[model samples]
Target: MSTTKGHADRDVTEDLLDGVAGWGPVLCHLGIFELVPVTFDLGIPLVARWMNDPAVAAYWDLAGPEIRTTRHIRVQLHGDGRSVPCLGVLNGTPMSYWEIYRADLDQLARYYPALPQDTGIHLLIGAPEDRGRGVGGILLRAVTELVLDKRPACRQVVGEPDVRNASSRRVFRKAGFDFVAEVDLLSKRAALMIRDRLTLYPYEIPRFDGYS
Candidate 1:
């Protein structure tokens, strides 16, 4: 058990290093435009505004207090045993957000093979005033570059969206993710679509760990 834990830790460290080193040159250029960081608090309102938009909310099935509660942001920022939130800022202003998480594949088993680390990106573009100005696209591109540079070991990143949300699906496709599957929600008829990239990883978590 001790040796296994040690090995895992080492691999994680290596992954982080490889990811960072690979992006070092890009980071220097990114600094000129100032696109950085994956965590944010000042951007909460931006996220709330975009996510709360009726058109946006239509797909999420979130409304009223559920949308108003701080729990969602809290979970997005702190959930999955992470301490820092992954937020993207543009021109010194918060414009997008994402998270790196290790989620239980047991729940995803109906669709994908189990993964040891499941990275995810939840991008939100606020300041509707800035919508279609290329801000969302730029930030997403930057975030993808950031993730690839920061997480070298990640073979794939996963995203789920409402089947009807065309705009978001386009942004994801532009970011290099491929359509993987469509998942049935609680309603059975309504489904969430799944997308992923084939980055490839060296390790995987077994399906039955007996802890869940």
Candidate 2:
């Protein structure tokens, strides 16, 4: 929690991210670009836009007014100390929103066999314009590698997007994820998607200059 003065100092979150010395310089480049934390200031507006759009809002189950959605995003920024709230940035621009959480501590744990090192992900691209250009598959691959690399103990990464979202399921498949099963979650049928660490790295991913 660092001090940021309005939008003028919005980039201040960059400094707070840098100060985590234990993370080392490797974190400065997450596979390709930066996987920076979504700070208080940056999280509010960008998240509001993504969650309120008619095309996307249904995926997140955030309905009613804009203020309700904003509060939901704020609570995540404030109280979600268990997971990493991430911004997938290419060069310096934020391209997507991502969260990497411990499966044992996640709601999905009850539905599936929980493992000590399993990680769960929730993701959505922030811009509606970038929905179906095959950009999502690329972003999914990058974010998956970043999460696996960040957690050395993690052996598998999992996601459950609504089964009704056909395009999202395609992106997961393109990114090398396998469909496990469909489970009822949040009152919607979600397709369980899994990508093993080996699947993300083994012979699947090409060598990136900054990637370990």
Candidate 3:
């Protein structure tokens, strides 16, 4: 795996994600959100359970067992620094899972007009309470901002949610991702969502009355 000097002078590998482990927390409307890099021993069970949720499994399809989810995460954890899996913590609680990757270097590049430094995001709101209440869109926008801010080379953030998953597609749209096209992937047809850095500010998260 590739390594880079990051926060606190640590040798954080996964440079293809531009030192994501060092990006730290971002304060959003909902709460303080952070994308902590995933560790197998601490992450597997929680992630596996989330994968088994019917709503998540419908699109993610990694519903069977812990080993199934383990293998999925293992590939990224052990591969070249093109992807990084993380636990999305909100206000000190790990409530979601995310995979931040280099879309230009992924198999996804074969399907789209991939540009250098095009970041990709794969997310699942793990808890039942966090779903269907605009949390997805809120975090999508927050994470997109993090990518654009932390990875200066990334001009756009992209996602390929299964086309049949309307709720997922809707959240992407609500978060400022433009529906670029429908691409057929090995597993399912996907809606290509792109959030261009050039036009992101208009849809940026708004400040609430009491929040700093």
Candidate 4:
């Protein structure tokens, strides 16, 4: 159910992500944040360790072994340039994992009214010390702003965090994303969140009646 109409015949040589490797670093309240494109040699072992964390595994479900994480990342690494896996490096340390993709050309398009050049984000804060603080929101804001800044054609940045994960949903809202809807994905019920280019500033905290 991929909505790859205009993109169906796109040249394989053209990057669907518009070269995330060159997006460069952005300054944030936390520190200088950068999205370093993932490589098997550098990303596999680190990501595998994060996946094994109890808090991460409960939702991501890729907890078993390094091979499982390798296979997961390998698919995106070798696939059509629609998705790019990146390591979130803050200041000087790689502390998070992210997947930036074209939502309009993705399976997610089937579940929502997606617009052309819509970008999607998938994130996981890697270390326990970085969790439960304001790190996720700060990094999410920086990355979303980076996406909108680097990809002008992309009018919005979207994410689907598990509905049960109240902390994750709150992080999105704190990052200036509004709750769009509840979508039922294959593995979990997700809370669709969206941050539009039109309202990237003057941050407003969204109010949810009884979401949690």
- Point to the candidate with the largest lDDT: 3
Worst 10 residues of 3 by lDDT: 1-10
Per-residue lDDT of model 4, residues 169-203, tens digit only: 99999999999899887778889999989988755
Off by over 4 Å in 1: 1-41, 61-67, 76-78, 82-85, 103-106, 186-212
lDDT of the candidates, in the order given: 0.46, 0.65, 0.84, 0.82
| Native RMSD of candidate 1 (Å) | 10.9
Question: What TM-score would you give candidate 1 relative to the actual structure?
Answer: 0.61
TM-score of 3: 0.89
lDDT of 2 by residue, 72-155 (tens): 555544542445567766656776877655666566777877677677777788787777987778777766775676567777
List model 1 lDDT by residue over 12-117, tens digit each: 5334333221232222222322333333445455556666777656754444553462455554333323222344544355555454443223244345664555
Once fitted onto the true fold, the runs of candidate 2 whose alpha carbons sit more than 4 angstroms away are 1-32, 63-66, 203-212
The best candidate by TM-score is: 3
Residue-pair clashes per prediction, in order, are: 9, 0, 0, 0
How far is each candidate from the true structure, as Cα RMSD in Å? 10.9, 7.1, 4.7, 7.8
Candidate order (lDDT): 3, 4, 2, 1
lDDT, candidate 3, 16-81, per-residue tens = 677888787877989888899887777889999999999999988899979998988877776666
